[model samples]
Structure formats: structure tokens, C-alpha cells
Target chain A: MTDESDGNPIERTGDEPPDGAPPGGGQRDRGDPGASDRELAADGGLSAGAETDSEPRIAFYGGKWASTIPLAFFILWAIFQSGVLGIGDTNGLVIGALVGTILGMFFARGDWKTYADTIFEGMTQRVAATAIVAWLWAGMFADTLQVGGFVEGLIFAADALNVGAATFPAAAFVLCGLLATGIGTGYGATIAFVTLFFPAGVLIGANPVLLFAAILSGAVFGDNLAPVSDTTIVSAVTQDADIGGVVASRFKYAIAAAIPAFVAYLIMGSMLSGASLEGSAALRETATALGLVHLLSMGVVIATAIAGRHIVEAISWGLVVAVAFNLVFGLSSVSDILVFTVTEAGAFTSLPFVAVGETASVGGSLYSGATGFFPLIVLTLLIVSMAQIMIRGGGFAAIQEFLLNSVATNVRRAELTMVLGTATINGMITINTAAEIAIAPYIARIGEKFNINGYRRANILDANTSALGYIFPWAGGVLVGYQVMVGPEGLGAEYGPEMVVNPIEVVPYVFHGWFLVIVFLIAAVTGFGREYIPDRTSEEVSRA
Target chain B: MSRFDKFFAGLSFRGSTPDYDPGDVIEVMVTGEEGGEVVARIGDSTLRIEDAPADAVNTRVLVAIDTWDEAGHRGTGTYRETVGKSAF
Candidate 1:
């Protein structure tokens, strides 16, 4: 086969046989094949029969391989730095990101200018836009609610449930799940619930690990299914499905898994409720004080979100409402609110003298608000740039072509492939938004080929990815959970182990994650409750 | 060329192509880095394909495909691809 004029080997221009072609040739015409082969070749094609070739298949330490190589190293360094390896603790991810970016340039394959452009693009669009937006809006809302005592209100609500000690953890689990769904962030939910509910659960004689697991489960549930969740949006948009359809289709599967998990937590809570703490009244009073001032913020966020507003717009409104509540409810003076919002602990202290472990001053607060997302923002940029690089490098086309061809033969296998593929991407990225972006094209393609309903595909992809992310210890969700576990009043003493539930320990207790997987698998096999396949011919008419 | 031929020629074979009903059994060849050959039954309109790591010698696997007909009927026929890639 001669290479084509466009430098593409096996490139097909027309779909017809050559004139005067012999019958029964069973061979593709010169211009019959698509652009798959050439694309693959450019992307470091798999060894054809493994003959020895010194062509230097993109080395990790080299410039052409910088993105993948440095990313891997950064993850490893972060794992170690975050005390995942039980060695001396350091900021592994932070250091890894810094060193990795610098080292990446050395191994990049293109010219200095191209590499610089790629890096800048990676930092700005992927990292800055997505991660910064997520952190800023989420952080602003979280901080606003904190000042308004939203967490305290939730605590008071939980206490008022007056459930038996045996069922308290389960109740907490449900409450946390609802809170996460309402807030549209698993990490925020994990932090808030763990701070409030974990300590309360421990004080109330519940198994600390179990309690922690409940919180984690709730986080996964909300992350997997919430309409406003970044994961949900990414999944739906990427799959080309509407948000309502995605949520509705996913509801059956999510609930199936969640109900059993909820029951199991109740059972476990009953078995584990034996610990007791004194001064319940004092804790109640504190919770009540916080609760009385913050009730409206939750309502504002929920109402705005349910009104079908854009996420940013909804969150902005929520923030304004929270600020208003702070004033109207007399929760904090305007000055105090301003100071809390703007100041961090370090700024108020003397500049010349070192103060140990002080709260952030107003300037520090502003700085953190601005820069706390820098690392995530940078990582997001790198990953997106890497994705673009991969696409440009032809890796995406190669994989996509292969998937489409394979999916054409079967439907069941196609569904499973979408589920597993989404999960794998989520596992690697540990961020649902990134994972959805990376995998949505493939999922949508495969689903469409089988004529699978968009809603079903979106639900399965998002739910599985969301569920699996929190189960991986390296996942952001797990990391947040671990941070909560290690806090002063976490599960450390009660569980007799460090507060951080090893990813392994938490996996078994991540009932929602496990349940979601099983439910998806069952739905795939049983074909129960599958929705009608959309008719493309009718979409316009229906919409009109 | 006939209208159908022109249509097929212009059709995108990417993810946006409309779905087809591939009767009781459908055969597909996975071509790419992890290329392989597999056949599966179409139970619904969707199909899932799984490709392992490049080093894993196993051929790509076809796990499931939705064969459910639009009328919720289960039977044989080559369903036409209606929705095009442009919709996505």
C-alpha cells in the first residue's frame, strides 16, 4: 500500500471500488481505509510483530513524553507527600507539581515555543477555568455558609432528629448525602459532615470508622447524582444528554444501591453505638447558636438551584443570600463578617516575628481565597493541555476508532465498556469533572452506535465514575475524608487507629459506591427499567 | 450514485452516527492499538467495548449491547441508523 499524498498511510479518499475491479477481491480499494493507520503511526504505534527498532518510543524523561511522565511522577510524589506511604510527611503533590512542570519542559518533544504555548494553555483553560471556578464558587458558598453557621444549623437539625444511638450514624449518613446533593460538591460535604457529624457520632458512641464511612458514602452519592454536581454536568454535556434526563435515568440505579447501603449503615450503627460523651447540652447550645443564624442560607442555595438557574448564577445568589442572612439574623456584625471573609490568621500578627499556628488574617483569607486553588488550577490546566496534546498527537482518534468499530457488534458489551471506561478514567484523574471530559466522547459514541438512550448512558457513566472516585484512596474525595479523619476530634482515639481510614478500610464501608456498581451491573444484565430510545427524526418536532 | 449511496458516503462513522438494530447477533472488528475481533448480540441500541492496556495481549472484548427495539419488541431486523453524529 503506497502512502497517500497527505502523508497518511492507508488513507482512504473515496468509498467506492476502483473501476474495472475484479469481483470477489475481498480487498479494500487504495482510497477505502480511513485515517486510522497514519494517525496511530504518528502516535507511537504498537509494535507490529515486535521487531527490534531503535526509534526511541517516547521516553518518559524526554520532552515528547513530559506530560504523561511528569504527571505520573507528580502523583507518586503527592502520594508520598500526603503521607500515603507512612514515611515522613511532606507536601508531595505541591512539590511534585512545581518540579514536574519544570522537568516536563525538558522532555517535551516540540520546539521551546510550542512547549511554552502548551504549558500556558494547560494552565489557563483546563486548570484556571474549571478548577478555579469550582473552588471559588464552592469555597465562597462554603465560607459564607460557615459564617452564617449553616453547618451548625445542620448539626442542630441532626440532633433534633432524636434518633436512637443505633440509627444515628445511618441518619447522619442520609443527612450528609442530602447536604452534599444540595451543595453539589462531595468534597465540601465531606469536610462539613466530617467536622460536624463525625465528632458527634464519636461522642454519641458510634463506630468512628463506620461514621466516617457514612460521611464518605453520602459524599459519593451526591457527587454521583446531584444535578448541579460538576461530575453530573460534565457527564451529561459530554454525553450530549439533557441534565433532567440524566438525573431521572440515574435515579433508579442510584436509589437501588443507596437503599441497601442505608439499611446496612443502620445495622452497623446499631451494632457500634456504645461510646458516650459528657456535656451534651453545651454541644447542643453551640449547635443551636450556629443553627439559628444559618437556616436561610441553605434554603437560598437549594431554592435557586432547583429553579434551574446556571450553577454559577445559583451559587452567586446563594452567596448573596448567605451574606444577607449574616446581617439580618444577627449571626455576626458586618465588620466581623468582612474580617472573617477577608482575613487569615497570619496577617494580624507582627510581620517581623514568627507566630506559630495562628488563624489566617483578612489578607491571608483573601490570599487563600485567591490562591488556595492554584495547585488544582495548575493541575487542571496540565491535564487539559495533555488531553489536547493527546488529541493532536492522534492518540484520541486511534482509541476512538477502535472503540467504535468494536462497539458496532454488540450492545451489552458496549454498556459495560462505557461504565468501566468511565470508572477507569475517574480513578486515574480522581476528579470527576476531568474524567467526564476525558471519557464523554467515547461513551457518547459507543452509546449512540447501539442506539442506547442518552439518559441511560449519561447516568451510567457519571454514576460509576462518581462512585469509584471516592473509593480510591488517592482520589480527592478520599483525601478530603482522610483530612477530616485526622482532625483533632476525629476517629483517632475512638477507632484506636489513625483517623485516616486507609483507602482499603473505607472501601468496604463505602456502601453507596459498592451499591452503585452492583446496581449498574444488574441493570446492564437485566435490562430493567430501560427508557425509550430517542428518535432523532422527532427531536426537532418534540422540541418545537 | 444512488441517494442511499451518497448518504452512506457522507455519513460520519464516528460516535455521532445514528444507531442501527443489529438483529440477534452482530460482528465487529476493533481496530486500533489494542485491536482485536469480537462478535456480540444486540440486546438494545447501545454497545459497550472494553480495551485493556496496550501491553495486555488479550484482544479487545465486547461486553454488552442493547437489543431492545423502539416498540420494546425483541426480534430481528437491521435497524436503520437515523440520528447522525451532528446531533451530538
Candidate 2:
């Protein structure tokens, strides 16, 4: 590669990357000029001529190619545990993290003290701190609404519309999109709509398979666009963008894709829905005004965040309002607000704690709201610590150098690479959030070089991240949806085998996912939404 | 070529040569000495200023771009006392 970078290499008196030093350790022949140049960039000196006179010591690889250990272990573990073993993401990450750290210790060159400090440094990195705090607040607020009947309110609204079989599928897309956006969990929306709305849609002569795909498409939209979504949160924090900025910036692309998907659903609904839904009209539950009240709570959070209040404070306000609304509006009682009732209590049998019986339950909207994110919280923190090691060891920097050199020669190519790379990762992984976390750092490092706005990079990362996971057959979303279609035993006995939709059948109908990918591709090549750095400082748009 | 392609063709970054408009203000860090010339680095590109204050070698300073060659990505600048980069 030509050093198009103007100016002579700084005559480094010291601290320059030795000619053959690779971040992974071990010697290269120094014969390959391209490899040596990349090593220099990744070595943290960054400049051809070394400046600043100081660079942090990185070690433990012992000339055996060690810096790549953490990333290698984590990626392999994610593939095996999630992709192969079909294990939960949280469990796999914890195990992968612990094992990776242990391996880092064995391969690391320095004393135990340095390794321990590195772990601490990584854990407290600004990105991790920013994301963990945001997720905590977002989780609590989301949980509060879910408990206070957000889903039920949406269902009530859908029922009252009483659209024909031809319109029911379109209604399903809109309702499921609202529910998932409000709740910030596409899987939850999938399950709720599949079990509740799916049967209802079928009675109206809505095509079951199309309805299922519509629900999934709605989920892709929500997951891609929702402010409170885990994938959205991860993408923003990793790219040094604020959640509010990311949500606002990505909205155009999301709506552009969704319009086409909605039209497709309407067309499909008309052609496929032939059965009569006459008798099921008797099955309407009174839609509660209280269930709809949670919309105000969601608005409060989004409004406060956009106005530039601290995220922690914004979420706290939303949580408080939600709990209050549940109580004051007669949506939930005091017990439902927060409770510890012992049905069979043993641990809290003493006087300080009260038990209903030998066992006790500790739950309420508040409890579930906050605790719902415990697994993900731990997952985020652990992965960040592991990421910190990779960064300091130049693992990320090496990849950064290669990306800039081999393919992303300019802004357009860089953005396209981000979209394609995120898509490939999400396609192979069964769990969407795991895929997001795995690819986020690379996106951040590569995107930074072109001065692409954090929001733009984050949008690209999340859109493709959510799109692939729900469309692929091995994806957890697709599998779970298929299982639901097949009924309780996966035998399709309850709905009858004919009603069951194969995962492949739904793939073509996942219109929103495909459209989202295309919108981002256009955004990348055209620089439609690109914003360069320092145009607005972090204080204006980010806490990270 | 399409106008759309031409419209987006000029943007590039992550360069070793310091890129700045002729009248742009930039942030630079002074790092080392090269034969009595004070070398400063900006945006990952380093060049010898030929003549700089002795004390300026280890400090971040502001500059006004006097000239630039886009293909070379190299430029010369005189110092500005006010510092520019934010805490973020």
C-alpha cells in the first residue's frame, strides 16, 4: 500500500513499533512491507513518526501470538455455546469471559498486578459505564410498562378496529410494532403476538404464515429502531453515541423500509386470507384505559433524553411515573407495585421478613423491571472487561489497521464494510444481542477513522444486527417462532400440522428486514446520513 | 459517472498527511526534535515545522493553516495561543 498519508515518517527517537513486532507477538520476517506497516499502526504509536514520547506497555503474549487470545476465545465460545449448543447468551458469555481471562493470565508477560489492573481499567471504561447505566434505567422503565398492561392495551386497540381478514395482517404489523417499540424487546413481542394475536388473526381468516412473518417483521423494525432496545443500546455505547441521537438518526431509514413492508403485508393479506372470522367476534375483552396510560410514561423518557437530560435521571423519572400511574390509575394495586409474599417461605421466615408460607415470592412491576436486565447487565460488563484487554493489547488496533488498509480506503467503503460485516456476524450467530456485542468494537474502531458520526455507525450496526437474526432458519427468533407455530410439542397437533409455518416459508416474507438492509446500504454509499466528528461534541449528544 | 458518485467522491480521512483547508484551524501536539527543527503531530500526521519555540515541543497548540496540498496532505501553519480539542 502506498503511504498516501502526507509527510515524512517522524524520526522516532524511541517508542516506535519495532519493524517486525505484531500485536499477537512472535516475529514476522519483516519481508512483507504491508504487514509491517499495519503492525506499526496497531502498536498504538499510530503515527509513522512516533510522538507523545510515551506508550503503554502491552504484554503476556510471550512471543506466541498472545494479544488475540481474549477476542479469539470469546468469538469461538459464542459460536459454540450459542450457535452449536443452543445455550442462553448470558450463560455462554460468563463462561467464555472467565475462561478467556484465565487464558490471558497464562499467556500474559507481566506480573499478576498488571493483568489485574488491566481488568479494572477495562471494566470502568467510559463506554461500559455509559451503556450499563443506560440499560439499567431503560430496563426498569420498560418492565414497568409491560407489567402495567402495555401489551393488553395494544391488543385492545387492535380488537376494537375489527378489520377484515385482508386488513388484519396489516393491523398485526402495526400493533406488534407499537408493542415491541414500547417494550423494547422483539422476542417478547414475537411471543405475545404469536400466542395472542396469531390465533385471533387466524379466526379472521388472516394467513397464519404471513401473520407470523408480519409479527417477526414488526419485531425487526422495533429492534432496529426502538430507543430502549438492547441491540440499540449496545450499538450506541460502543460507537460513542448517545441513545437519543442514535434513535433520531436511524428513524428515517427504519420508516423508509417499514412502509414497503406494510404495503407487502396488505397485499399478502388480501390474497391469502380466505377463511371467515365471524364467530370469534364474541371474544372481546374490554380494553382498559389504564393499559394505554403507559404510553405517557414512554413519551416522558424519550422526551427527557432528547432534551439532553442525563440518561440516568431521565430513566429515573420515567420509572417513577410508571409505578405511580399503575397505582393511581387502578391498573395495579400496592402489592403489584412492589411485593414480597411468601407462598412457601423458608429464607425469610424470621420476623424481619414476612412470608405467606414455606415459599416466598419477591416481585412487582418495579422488581421485575429492574431485575429483568440482571443477566444482560452482567453480560455487558464482562464483555467490556474482555474488550478492554483486547484494546490495550492492540488486538482491536490490529484489526483496525487491516480494515483501513485492505478494504475501507475511504468513507463510502468504510460504511459499507460496517453494514456487511455486521450482517455476516448476525447471520451466523443464533442470538442477536450476542452478535451485536461481538461486532460493535470493530465497527467503532473502523468507523472512527473516517470520522463517521457515532450515531450513523451505530445505526448501521444495529439495523443489520437485528435484520439477519430473525430471518435465518437457525436464528433463535425464527426457531422460537416456528416452535410456537408447531404448537406445544413441536408436533403441530394443537393448531394442526397444516397451520405450522416452516422457518424457510417466513424468510421471504420478512420484508422489513430485507428493506432495512437496503436502506442502510444506500445510506452508506450515498453518505445520506453521515455526520463527521467534532461537528458536535460529546457533551451535546453523548454520555459515553 | 453518475453525479451522485461524483458528489461523494471527495470525502476521505484516517490519513497520515495532515489535511486542512488553507484557512482552517487545527490542534497539534509537539512531540520531538529533528535536527533542531520542532516536529509536531496532528491527526496522526507528523512534520518538521523547521522553526518552532523551544518550549512548544511538548505542548498542544493551535495553528492557522497558511497553505496545503490535498494530494500531499501536508500543510504549514503558524501558532495560535488558544488551545482547541475538548475534554470529550
Candidate 3:
């Protein structure tokens, strides 16, 4: 074969791909440069420089609207499973997503090969990998801090303050918010606080519903603002803004909502009556001030991240410090950080972090923490793939065009669309981060069309996602907290069924979450904190 | 911006349509073509660019403002060069 343009003779051995061809040889028209480019684009392998332009565009049978069926189906499945059924299973959602993607294949207009190739293209995108990498690092760091007794230290501080029942909700809100911010997992914070702080507050005369709301409010606060938080990471990376910059820019919005929330908890704590439960004194005895040493570990992460260091590096530093604190302060044994067990005593049994047992397995804070996000990570990649399908199929562009032409003709309307668009998606999807991932592309397209700043776009996307995720009864944060109230080892086990706060009862009392959403709504209309593209540009995403 | 400045950024209530001064050079993405001229739309404001390449649409370019109408939030500028591509 002769290269058509260059007139160079090309010899092709049977079934052997030419040089520069992607592995897993596919037919390529070597004579036509455009044909080769199309083949490479379909493969989506190597040739990073042409990624953005060469991306495959898939067409659907039902026009642009049909492209959204995969994601929309998954969202409905999520609502039904997690919201209606009250089953917060990430693995189930994964299955729903897998089925949804396979279903979308039936709607392809032409060659299904392009549609299939698009899945690999979507999964391999840098955006998905970026969030996954950060989440894994953050998972390890946050879990280590938990093993180091960060929650107990806060309980100790709350005990020392002795603010009495009237102020306990306020105090718990602040403390829970701090823990959530430090650990970057609001669901984990919700479980910890509900288990440790909820019963104590009820025993001391704080209303159960108000106290539960306060805890959810705190989770929302941290989830919205934490640099290492999954939602925060998604919002930042989706908007192409650095995590540190996103956190810094969003502080004003978070604090604006948090202040009123704290005050509401205080006022309501005083007004609402509690069941005169006993044993508050017994709960206080288990806490230790030594657990507070991990505060420095949290601080190092925040400071280093804000200084423009990579998130992985910042969390690694925090992990190192937390382990050191655990060992030096004798808070937890070295084995608690990491340990391996085998059926028989082995040479590695002598190691400080190793143990021998009848069953071979691995256990420890780091192991559990990193592994905990596995389900979520898988769900995220699948969701992003669905999103890519939408993008290539022109669903996103069609939606953007409709919104811009009808609803978002002006910048104010654009901002309002973004705020409401995000809130609507999050309301239907039980997992806030997952919902954020699904809706991020829309926010980016709408925001960029109007030249909105990256930080502002990220803040708007995260605030609504974080807030709505906890305010609804089916929300992951609320559901997790409610579970602790009724689970076998929960407050009901000790305090009786009456101690469990009904999820519906706490809806209005989630002051922080309600306020955060309202703040964004007001910001959207009043143009408060509005920024244009020319106002500022974010630093490189790698530094986040 | 410095670390300290980051926390305080975007504190103001910015206008929907901002006015630019003549001779001010700024980098912006060329959003589309208007009446055979390249244009960059920053919020409600629009700037028509002259001397821009045919393929400048959807690409970032530096432009020097040559005329302004603050009331209409519209202006004209001269394209300096292509700086980058759209961020996907």
C-alpha cells in the first residue's frame, strides 16, 4: 500500500497493525490521514494531544433528548432504591447504572461500535481519575484520624466547655462540622456524631429532632467546604478550578449559612423539651482529651492544601502525622493503623503491624478507609461514563441551548438555572456526590457560556449538592444518622425506640442545610458574589 | 492571588454587564461568529473582534479593545493572537 499524501510505500503483514497504530488492531484506512485519526479517536488510546477535538460523538435514535435516558434511568433507580426503599446501597446503584448503560446501547442510531467505544472514552477521561485519586488519599487520611480518636477529643472538648443542655446542639453542630471538615466524609461524621453525641444531648435535655438536625447541618457544612470532600472535589475538578481555591472561595457562603444555623440550634435547643433521660454522666466518662492531638493533623492538611500542594501529598502528610500522634500519645495501638492476620503464625507475625489468627484477612483503619470508597469509586466512573454518553450524543448541548434560549437569556437567569438545576438533580439522587457528578457537566457548560468564574461555579454547584443531600429524608446523611438511631447497636438498643428521631420530623430543623440552599437561591437572584471569567482564573488543577 | 487573598476574592456584587476601557487588553474565548466577525461574550457584554482567524471560534484569544459603548455593553476590538483552546 502507498501512503496517498506522502507517496511512501507502506507494507502491511497479514493482521499486523502498522507502527503508531493502537494495540488490539482494528481496520484503518492508512492511505487517508483523517481515516487514521478517526480510528485512533474511536480507540481513544494514546495521542493525548488531540483528545478534546478527536473525541467520538455518538448519535441516538430519539434525537438529543434520548441520550439522557441512561443517566435518567439511574437517577430514578437511585431514588426508588435509596429514597423510597430506604436502602443506601452503593453496589445496587452500580448495578442500576450498568443496566442503564446497556439499555442505552439499544438507542444508537448507527454503528454500535462508536457507542461502545465511547464508554471506554468516558471512563478514561482525566476528570474521573482526578476525583478518584483524591478520594482514595482522603479516605486513608480521614480513616486514620477516626482511629486516632478525633471524635472522642471533640466530645472531651464539649464536656470541658460545659455549655449545658441549652447550648449542646450549637456546640455539637460546631464540633461535628469540624470533624466532617477534617475527615472529608459527611456520612462518616454523621454516623460518629449520631452515635456519640446524639444520645448525650438527649440525656441532657436537648430535643432529639433538633439535635439530629444539627448533626445533619454540620455534615452539610463540611461536605460543602471541605477540600478533600468528594462533592467539593467533584465541583472543583468539573469546573476546572483547584480544590484549595474552591474551598477558599466558598468559605463566605458556608459561613454565611452556618452562623444562622448555629444560632437556630441554640434557640431551639432552649425551647424544645427532651425526655429526662439519664446516663449522660456515664457517656462523658469514655472521652479523653488526648484524642484532640489529631487536630494538628487536620490543620496540616488544610494549610498545605491551601499553600498549593497537591491534595494527595497534603493528605499523606496528614496521615503520617495522625499515625505518629496515635503511637506517641498511646491513643491507639500500631496494629490499629494496619494489621494482617494469617491462618498460622508466620515470620511477619513479629512485625508490629502484623497479627496471626485462624482466619487470614487484613484489618486496620487504612485498609477499611481506602476500601470503603471502592463502591463509591466504581459508581462514580459508571456515572461519568453515562455523562460522557450524554455529552457525545448532544443531550447536554440540547439542554444548554434550551435553557440559554428560553430561561437563561441573561446572566441572572443563567445563575438561577444553575442553582435550581443542581438542586433538582440532587433532590432526586440520594447520594450527593453521585448527583454532583451527574450534574457537573451541565453546570460547567451553562457557567462557561456566560463566562462565569470557575470558583463561583464550583461554589454554586457544591453548595446546592451538599445542602439538599442532607435536608431530604432519603438523603445519605439523614439516612445514615437515622440508621444509627434505630440500628441494633444504636441509641434504640440502649435508650429504647422512643429515642429514635423520625427522619421526617427533622426536615425543617436542618437549619444549616436549608439555609445553605436558600443562600444560593438569594445569591442567584441578587447577583451577590457574582464573578465573571475575566475577574479571575484558577490555578492549575494538578495543584488541587 | 496569594493564599490570604483567595479567601476574600469575589466579595463584590458585580454587574451583569461590565464595561471595558479602550486600549485594555484581555484574554477571552471566542464564543461564536457574529455577522462574519468573531465575538467574545462575557456575561451580557459582547465584544466584536476584527482581524481574527477564521477558526478562532471556540478558542481563547488575546484582544485589544478599540471602541466601547458602556450603555449597550457592546464594543469592538482587534484580535492579537490565539492563546489556547476551549476547555472541553
In terms of TM-score, the best-performing candidate is 3
Better of 1 and 2 by DockQ: 2
For residues A1-544, write the lDDT of model 1, one tens digit per residue: 0111211111211111111222212232256343223322233221221221211222223323244545556555655554365322223344565576566557644354554555554454322353356556655665556656666777787777776567877887787787777666787788888766776766666666777778888888888766556677666555545454455456667778899999999888877645555434555566764544444565565555444455566667776776787777776555434443323445643442223344544532223343544555555555555544433323444465555445433555667777778777676555555556556656755554444555666777888888876776667787776765665765565444533456556668888988888777766655544432432211111010
User: Can you tell me the CAPRI class of model 3?
Assistant: acceptable
Task: Give the winner by DockQ.
Answer: 3
Give the count of colliding residue pairs in each prediction. 51, 13, 0
Number of the predicted model whose lDDT against the real structure is largest? 3
DockQ of 2: 0.10
Residues B1-88, model 3: lDDT tens digits: 8899999998777787888999999877665554456677778787778999865655668899999888777888999988665445
Query: Between the candidate structures 1 and 3, which one is better when assessed by lDDT?
Result: 3
TM-score of 3: 0.90
Query: What is every candidate's alpha-carbon RMSD to the true fold?
Result: 11.8, 7.3, 8.5
Q: Quick one: ranking by lDDT, best first? A: 3, 2, 1
The residue-level lDDT of candidate 3 at A537 comes to 76
> What is the two-chain DockQ of model 1?
0.06
Off by over 4 Å in 2: A1-4, A7-66, A85-89, A103-117, A272-283, A286-290, A343-358, A474-501, A534-544, B1-88
How does candidate 1 score on lDDT?
A: 0.53
lDDT of 2: 0.64
Candidate 2 lDDT over A1-544, as tens digits, reads 1233322222321213332343334453346433333333343321111321232435655432465687578777867775576554465576787788878777766565666666776666565566667766776677677767776787677766767678887888888887777667787678767766776677667887788888898888888877777788778766656677677667777888999999999998889854443445543463455588888887777677656566677778878888889878877666665667777657654533244644567776667766766766676666666665665565655565566667766567778899999998888766677678767867755565444546667889999998987887767677666666665654256545555676767888888998899988877776666655423322244464
